[model samples]
Structure formats: structure tokens, C-alpha cells
Target chain A: MNRLLAATLLSLVSSPVLACDAVQLGTIEVEQAWSRASIGTSRPGVVYLTIRNAGTEDDALVSIDTPISGMPMLHETVVTDGIASMPHAMEVPVPADATVALEPGGYHGMLMDLTQVLKEGESFPVTLTFRNAGEVTVPVSVQGVGATDAGCSENNG
Target chain B: MRLTRLQKALWVAAGLAIVAFGVLVTIMNRAPEPAAQASFRPTFSLPDAEGRLRTAAEFEGKHLLVFFGFTNCPDVCPTTLSEVGQVMDDLGDEAEEVQPLFISIDPERDRELGLAEYTNAFHPAILGLAGDQAQTRAAADSFHIYYEREDTADASGEYSMSHSPALYLVGPEGDWLRQFTYGTPASDIVSDLQSRL
Candidate 1:
């Protein structure tokens, strides 16, 4: 019983810290990963994050994997002539020493076939694979429904 | 040439007739064109989330905020709805006089997915409307909204919908008032609505 209590306390104390910290692999830093609370299980969800490449070499986000979703894909919402179309992005190129922000009304990570409803204040782990930087898992916090931004300071890292 | 009294009276009548015809033509050209007005002033009859038949007449005396989108849309639709919610909140008590309707372009899937639940997550005041394919098409036609399903579908047979992203504002008299284009800030929309309301 004492061991179980200690494990529970440790999980509660470590979860938030893990979600708040930015993950760095090589020179690629992934931060401010967040998603809005889902309305229903049938519809898809989305994840927004910022990827900054500090190295002189350019990289690209090739793929994404998350246990919360069955099919995770990178999609871009293109608005042309007042029409909006969401197309599957083959890959998002991150230039050298530049930041690529996956935001609303632009590029975003589409979470298809959600296993469970994303509740507010919860966090999920998503493994983002880069062409050059390899793979790095980042914790994505679930914000309120219709949240525009992560609503947190970048200094949390 | 000297004219007789009868000829002089006939000449005066002809001049008066020409003047009257010129005045009539100018008035006709200056009058509002019904065809142009009718094109802009569109109406619709569809079923709401509660399955009740709702028409434009039902929203008489209140401004109608209409947007066309689908619940399956993960990005632009929700972002626009959130901005609409912000506008409503900024309106404060004046929001009561505004009715925001989210018309689903993908009605079949939206109905099964629970449209009300999806919209209420952004704003409870936003009413989600869906209809059969024919009815949905008719409503979209009236509003000049365009929507097309992509040929590509996921392994689960789910597809995405491409649609117009403009938010239309209808006056209390059921006339097209203004259009808030995609990405317009909520503050601008609130100020416009407040001035009109």
C-alpha cells in the first residue's frame, strides 16, 4: 500500500512538468504542443505546435504517431477565393534556423479516429518524426474547446 | 411661319409630353433594382438540430448570423465558430437580438455525429442546422454557399468537405446586410453588429 501511494503521488507530480517542458532532439526544439478539447468521438481532433530548428541544416516533419488517434496526419487548411480546403500535407518543410508553427487556419496535425474524448486540462503524448532530426515525443496539453492558442507562456520550458 | 391657335396648342402638348417622358425614364433608372436586391436577399427553410423546421421568417426582428460548414472540419470551421462566440460575448446583452446559425454542408454525417453537441461546445447560442441532401443543397443555393465533398476518403470511408468560409449577417428585415469574410477579427464583427443593433 505504501508503494502504491508513492507511485500515485509521483505520477501526479511529474505529469504536468513533463507536459510543460519543451522537447529537444539534436537542434530541433518542439514546444507549445496543444490541442482543443474534442466535442465528440465521431469527429476528428487537431494538434497545434511550434517546431524551431536551431541548426544550419533544414529539416522537414515527415510523420506523426499518437496512441490517442488511429491515423495521425499533417494537413493544411488552404483558403483561396473564399473557399477553404483541408488537404493532406505530404510533409512540412522547416527551413534552417526558422520556426514552423502548426496553427489554426493553417498547418495542423489531424487526429483521426480518436480512441477517447480529449478532455480539457488533459495532456497526451505525440511522437513527431523529422526527416533529419529523427523522432521526438512531445506532450500536448488539451485546452478548452475552441481555444485559439496554448494559453501558456513559452518560458515554461 | 405664323401658327394658328390650334397648332400652337398642339406644339405645347408635344413639348410637355417629351419632358414627361424624359422625367419618367430618369426616375425608372434611379429606382432600386429588384432583381439585384433579390439576388442578395436570400432565404431558406431547413430543420434545426432539434429536427424542427425553421425558416428565415422565424428569425424576424432579429439579426441572423449564418455560416456554412461541417462538423468534420477540424480547423477553419471551429476557428470561425470561436470567433463568432467571441463576437457574441462582446455584444453582451445585445447578443439576444442576434441569432447565429451553423448550417451543415455535410448533413448526413453531421446528423449522425450530433450537430448540437459539436456546436454547443463552441457556443450554446449557436444553432446547428442540417437537412437531407436536396434540402441542404437548396439552402446552400439560396445563400450562395459552395460545398463539395472530396473524392479522397480515409480507410474508414470518411471524407472531408471543402466549403466557403464567409459569415453572412442578415438584417432584422431578412435582407443581406454584410458579409464577414474568413479570418476577419471578432472585434470588427462585434463593432459592426453593435453599430447596427
Candidate 2:
């Protein structure tokens, strides 16, 4: 019993650190935080991630903050009549026991006026605030310039 | 038992009618229904990524894949470009026969250098073309492509573009062959191109 308790405690403490892409705040779990690499001095780099809510209550992503960008805003790309339009979102909802994917051609967080170019194999930090879960910061890995799929299989947190 | 003369005549007539129906079906199957293609005037002379004036006549001997989007578009544009790159990759040496042309709708933001950067990120062989408002409008209008800037509410003054997400496939002589809708898998595109080749 004592050994089992120790193992559980160790897992609970080291889980977040072991999984660089996973962050937990209250019942909100953010995973596979990643962004695409950019060209020379390219501003307006977009960030993608998966937000999962495990709690019994609903939560909404209120805002996002990152020092690398001048303004981090929640945005979604809507394609209607074969025309794509991306508008600044007021908030993205994360309902209970549901998962929302911020992927290419869909919802993504825009880092407006990037201070530095995003390079491949590099990672940055981003803080996401939720209505109920408060806030959680996670490191976002920069994939290749044309990468679209999240490399979640490599690092499943 | 032998049939009577009247019964024999009826049976023969029925057999002939069945054979006629079979022939009609075969004829219908042999002639494939023509695909409805949107006709576009194959004409344009725009500056390529290297700032060299390129015309549709230059690519007369190869299949041209023309895509319209902006550099600021992070979603559909990149996704479609990546799919195009994958198609080229799967084509192997035959990719030389195909020219992927990316035409920017938002010429103000996507300058020559920016167009080069965006296209190079996908495939080196892809040509990124940008032009002034008049040139862009002519190119888009010639192809019947629709694109407009959506005024966003962000204080950063950043806006997104709404453009048709179809990839136009032109023949060697600048004839409209077919078009692929958005999110078409690379394998399907490769097969279509291969069949056409």
C-alpha cells in the first residue's frame, strides 16, 4: 500500500514535467501545443493545440498571452461558400468532458506582430486562461514550416 | 414441344427487343458523360516570385495547377499548399511536367519577396505570383475566382481574405481541364493528373 501510494504521488507530480506539451489547471488539460515555423522575419504566426476538459463543469478559453507576440488573440477561420474568413474570436468554449482542436483551417490562436521568427525544432511559451480553470502555461514546439498535423503520437501527454 | 407459328414470332420479337435494349445500354456506357467544366479565358501575364514577367503562354507545354490565396491566410492556404506539395512529392520525376502556380489575391500584403517565401516553404518548384490591384483583378476575373478582404474587429488592423478554395487544373495549351475542391487528398489528385497525362 505504501509503495503504491508513493508511485501515485510520483506520477501526479512528474506527469506535467515529463510531458512538455501537457499542462493542467483545475480540470483543463492542454496538449500537443505546437506552431508552424515561419519564413524570414515573418509576423503573425499561428499557434495550434488541443484543449480537453475533464471536469464536470464547462469552461471557456478567456484569453491568451505570450511575450513573443505583440497581441495574442483567439481567432477562428470560417469557410463559407468556398471562401475562407478568419475573425477574432471573443472566446472559445471548452465544455465538460469534451475536447476542442485548434488546428489548421480551423480555430487557432494568432500571435500578431511576432517579435521573432519561429524556427523549426524550437519551442516557445504560451499562457492560456480559462474561465473556470484559471490559467496554465505550456511550451509550444515549432514544427516545420509546412507542418499541419500535430505530432501527438510522439508525445502523448 | 415445337411452338406454333404465332408463338414463335412473338418470342423472336421479344428476343430482338431484349437485344436492342442491351445494345443501347452498351452504347450509353461506351460514351462517357462529359464533365461540366467552368470555362475560363486562359490569359495572364503577371510577375513571378523573381519579379520576372511571366505569361500563360510560357507554360503552354506543361500542365499548370493554379491556386489563388493570400500569404496572410494561415489555414486553408497553407493546408492546400501542403497538399499540393504532397501531390508533387508523390508524382516523383513526373512532377517536372506539372507547374504549380500560387497567385496571391492580396497583392498589397503579399509582395514579391513574401510570395517567394510562402511558395518556397511548400515546394521549390512552385511559382509564387503577385501583382498590383489591376493585375490581380484581371487574373482572378479571368478565372472567375472570387476573393474579398474581411474587415476584422481586431485592433491590430489585421484582416483575413475570403477567396474561392478551388485549384484549377489547366491543360498544356491553357485549356480548362478540371478543378479539385478543397481538402482533396493528394492520392486522388495524383491519380487524376496521371490519368490525364
Candidate 3:
């Protein structure tokens, strides 16, 4: 009976790792890392997520890396006088104890020269580098092209 | 001097007639003015997602919602197209009369297949279009669209483009109808389109 109970308890403990979409490390909580599925033959794919710094010290997102693309660059879409422009961002700021959303129409990461299409329902690992919090590897869930509201949380459910 | 009964009735009838005429004139003056006619819509024969040459003449009896953007556009294009998709949803059956096309300003990056993938991903009805630089420029000049290509640090000759985000609504007869500014709600677009239809 004790052996059976131990097995059941072990299964319960391992389930959280499979269900959790959030990765909390040190003072940073990264949630909802997601990307839209690439359209036919589109080489570049975009990724978005929310980074929250729960600690008092501010952090800067130094860089990002993923196996799906050799060069993942930070970019933001700027609109002036009804003109839309996407400019390269050298670094992104994560204010202390505040949440910063890297979402559509704002800050985003471009996966340049994707070797393969980012299909829907597929999840890939992306490593994010922070000046203060170090590096954390998060899974980015791929969603449909029209998906803006759907995220890793929904897919986790 | 007191008038006779017949004369009094005749006088009252004349007064009533004059009051009716005054009311009629007031209503005529108060009625709203007619809507101003739109300028001529610029026509183009661009390659669609399938690499097929599609012309403005093909959609002669259907209204078109044309927008200019590129596939690499991560933010505004998707947002606007998604909103346009919502407008299509709100339209229901009337959407059959309305067709949406996404014209690529960056033809170098947005090829026929890529354009097809990007546009139809938002809404099935949204068709993607692309053409060479000269064709794009001519189309832009005709539509009065302003766009600029900014060089990027990447070595692959890949660059970013900046262009207007307005949604152009073209009439069934290939005439310019209206332009919806960016961030306009889907309900407003649907209502405007419904009223026009």
C-alpha cells in the first residue's frame, strides 16, 4: 500500500511541470510566451510574452536565442503619422517589480530565417538572457495566425 | 363686417393650405444633404497569392476592402487584418458582397506564396497581392499611399518597410468609397459598410 501511494504521489508531483506555462526563476516570472504560426513560405516568425520582475532590482533583457532561428532579434513596431515601422531594439527594459508585456503592436522578437515553418500547437524552447536574472529557457507555444488573445496558458489548459 | 358661412369655410381652407405649404418648405430645407461622391479608385492588375494576374475588373460587382502591408509586419498588419476579420464576422451573409485584399508594399520579401500565407491566415477571404517595385510604386502613387523602405543591419538584403495603415473601401463599380483609419472598431466598419450597401 505504501509503495502504491508513493507512486501516486510521485505522479502528482511531476504533473505540475507538464501543466505549468509559467516559469518563475529568482525574481522574474515569465508567462504566456507564444508565437504565431508562420504563413506559407514566410521565413520570419514573431514571438511575444510578458515579463514581470517581482524583486526590487530592475533588469534588462540582454538577448534571446532559439534553435528554430539562428538570429533572434528584438524589434518594436513604431507608428508615426499613420506610418508603421519596425525598428531593431538593442535591449528591452524590465522595470523593478513591474510587468512589461512584449506583445503585438509593441515590443516583439523576430525569429529570422526560420528553417522550418512554425506550425500550430507546436512548442519550442527559447532562452532569454537578462542582465540581472541571468538566463531562463522558456517554451514558446505556436498559435494560429489570427491568434492574438490565445497564449501558452490556454494551450496548457 | 362678418362674412357668410361659405366664405368663412373657404377662408379657413386657404389658411390650412398655406400652413401645409409652409411646413412642406420647412421640411425640404431641414432634410439632410446628399453624401459627397468619392474620387475614382485606382485600378491595378497585380499578382495574387496564387501568382495569378488579378485585375480590378474581376471584382466588378463586388465591393473590395484593400489594405497595403507586408508579411513581415508583425504588429499593425495582423491587428488591422484581425479587426477586418472581425468586421467580416459581423457582416455574416452580407460579407459575400465584400472582399478583402492585402497588397504587399515590400514585394522583395512578400512573394506570391508568402503573401497568400500571410493574408489568408487572418481571414480566409483576405487575398494577398504582390508586384515588382515599379508596379508597387505606380499602385501607391495612384492610391496616394506613402511607404518607405528602411535598411536593416542584417546582411541578407532583408529590410523593414514603413507604410500607411489605412483600410481602403472600394465600391462595386470600382470607385473609391471610403477609407477607414487605423484603430477604427469593427462595429463602425460594419455599420458603415452596411449603410453603404
Candidate 4:
């Protein structure tokens, strides 16, 4: 019926809204988690998703943790020399009452040496530790093995 | 009628010029010129998901669409490969003429088995290429591609890469061809390949 009402209903059905009481800084929510399938002689894959910050104070995502791989790291994508080059994780600064997206062709998390192929219709837990806010566990949805788009036909796209 | 015969000639010339202008306009309304062809097709060797070595040179004399990215790349990597897959489908049998390559920038982890497995998830023709950093860098430089690592640290004291997203069109000669921007439709890629054929 209204904008607020619609946003509320959509969040409930799909993306779960996460905001904690202690930080007073903000809440970071992860959704639509996915990784590319292992390719040609390579066993490990990378994971991607959005880390939305919903709060009143500035939010900085310092690190990410996942058990599926030997190591979990955050990264940002850059293009140089007509190539895609990623160096390291950027301090994702989510402004007060705003959201920062971690989508395809951009910044995402790196999941290395996965225990197994992250299957679709299944989800895994990844704990994100914020500089100001403590650790928050988010269930990452393992998208289809063939899923290409970061997310099309959905808001993530 | 006071004018001379030469004056009459001048009036006819003016009329001819006016008609010629109209004809020029009609000619200008013809179809547009086709898109440009790729400069050259470049080739490199990288491991697959199963650790098998495949070379771009091996696919020579065939239409090839290769993209450079890493398996650790969750979003752009898959999207670009998927787009290449879509282009392959668009070509149907002609798609066989074009080979799709999924090259990884993150050679640190995208060894033989990882690369092969990652690429297999997409189209079979879509091969994944990976090598040691030294080899990968040489390949990247030859193709005029660029990539760098971002500083994303996890609990295990490690890093990740954040690189560019590029789709290179390598011709039969293993030279660099043209490229499509991100989000380009498969139909567009197919159309380009058709012209090359």
C-alpha cells in the first residue's frame, strides 16, 4: 500500500534485516551469497554477496570468516590494462543509514580451498567482524552452479 | 528574353546542382557500416579445472572468445563466463567455431584442478586457463590485460585479488582482437563472430 510497508514486507519474505543493539553504530546484513564453481584443474572458488549496512552511525566491515575454505578474505575489483585486477580488501565504509553492495565485477569475498563444491539450495555460515560492531553470522545462499549473473531478475543485479 | 544564350545555360546549371543535392541526400540514407573487426587473436596456456594444460594456440583456426578472471572472483567471473556461454548458444553450430576461455588472474589458488572444476560449471567449450604467477603475468602482459590484488584479510592471514573484467576476442592467428564491454548481450557477441566468419 505504501513505500515503507512494501519495503518491510519484501525484507521479511526474502532478505532478512539485521541490526544489533550493542554497536549503536549499525547493522551489516549479508544475502544472496554465491561463488563460482571450481574450473579447469582448479579446486578452490571465490564467493560473493552484498553486505548491507542499516544503522545510524558509520559502519566499517573489517574482516570476514568462513569455514568452507582454508582461508576467507575480502577483496575489491579493479580494471587496469584492459584486465580485471584485484589487490586487497577495502575498508567498506557504510555511511550512517546507507548500504554498500558487494556484487559481481566489483568487490567480493574470496573463499579459497573449499571443502567441497558449494551446492545450490544450500547455505553456509560466514561470520563478519566489524571494526566497531562485533561478529555477526550470516547464512550465505549457495546459488546454482551455473548461475552467471551476480543476480539478475533480483535486486542484487 | 533579354538574356543571352549563355545566361540560359547558367539557369540550367543551377537547376542541375539543385537536383544533384537531392540525389546526394538519398544516397546518404543508405544502411550503416558494420562493426569493426578485432585487431588480432592472442593465445596463452593455462591449466583447467582438472589440471589439464590447454593452450589458446591449440584452439587456433577456430573462433575463440576468452575472458580473464579468477575463480575466487564470485561475481564478475561467473557473469562474464556465463555471458560467453550465452554467446556460444546464440551461435548454435557456429558456436563451435568460437571457443570460450575463462582465464584466471588468481593463479595462487586456481591451479589445474580448481580451474578445470570452475570452468566445467559453465559451458564445456568454455575452458579455464591458469598458471603460476610468472606464467600468468607473461600471458596477461602479452594480451595487454591488467590485474591487481586487494587487501581483504581473513582470519587465516591471507589476501585476495580485485581485478578488471575483460572479454577478449582472439582470432585464428593467436593475436589480440576486439573486446566487448561488461553486460554485453550474447546476441551482440554472436553478431560479431558471424562477421569474422
Lowest lDDT block of 10, candidate 2 chain B: B33-42
Give each model a TM-score.
Answer: 0.85, 0.81, 0.76, 0.63
For candidate 3 chain B, which ten residues in a row score worst on lDDT?
Answer: B29-38
lDDT of 3 by residue, A22-131 (tens): 78889998877888777643557888888889999999887999888877889987778767788898889999989998887888998887877777776667889999
Q: Second chain of candidate 3: TM-score?
A: 0.77
Q: Per-residue lDDT tens digits of candidate 2, residues A33-146?
A: 888787765547888889999999999998999878887888888878766678778899999999998888788998877888887766777899998889888778777777
**Which segments of model 3 are wrong by more than 4 Å?**
A1-20, A40-42, A152-157, B1-40, B50-52, B185-188
Interface RMSD values for the candidates, listed in order?
0.8, 1.6, 1.7, 3.4
What is candidate 4's CA lDDT for residue B158? 47
Q: What lDDT is reached at residue A37 by model 3? A: 79
Cα lDDT tens digits for candidate 4, B1-197: 59899999999999999999989876675435222342544556766666677777678788677677766555566778777777777788887778787777877666633556566667777877677888788777767666776563447544446555767787777766777877677778888889888
In model 4 chain B, where is the ten-residue run with the lowest total lDDT? B31-40
* CA lDDT, candidate 2, residue B73: 70
Using DockQ as the measure, name the better of candidate 2 and candidate 4.
2
Regions of model 1 farther than 4 Å from truth: A1-20, A154-157, B1-39, B153-156
Q: Model 4, range A7-71, lDDT digits (tens) per residue?
A: 76455334322211111223655555555444321244566655566766787878888777776
Q: What is the interface root-mean-square deviation of candidate 3?
A: 1.7
DockQ of 1: 0.68
Q: Among these predicted structures, which one has the highest DockQ?
A: 1
As a whole number from 0 to 100, the lDDT of residue B104 in candidate 4 is: 75
Structure candidate 1, residue pairs in collision:
none
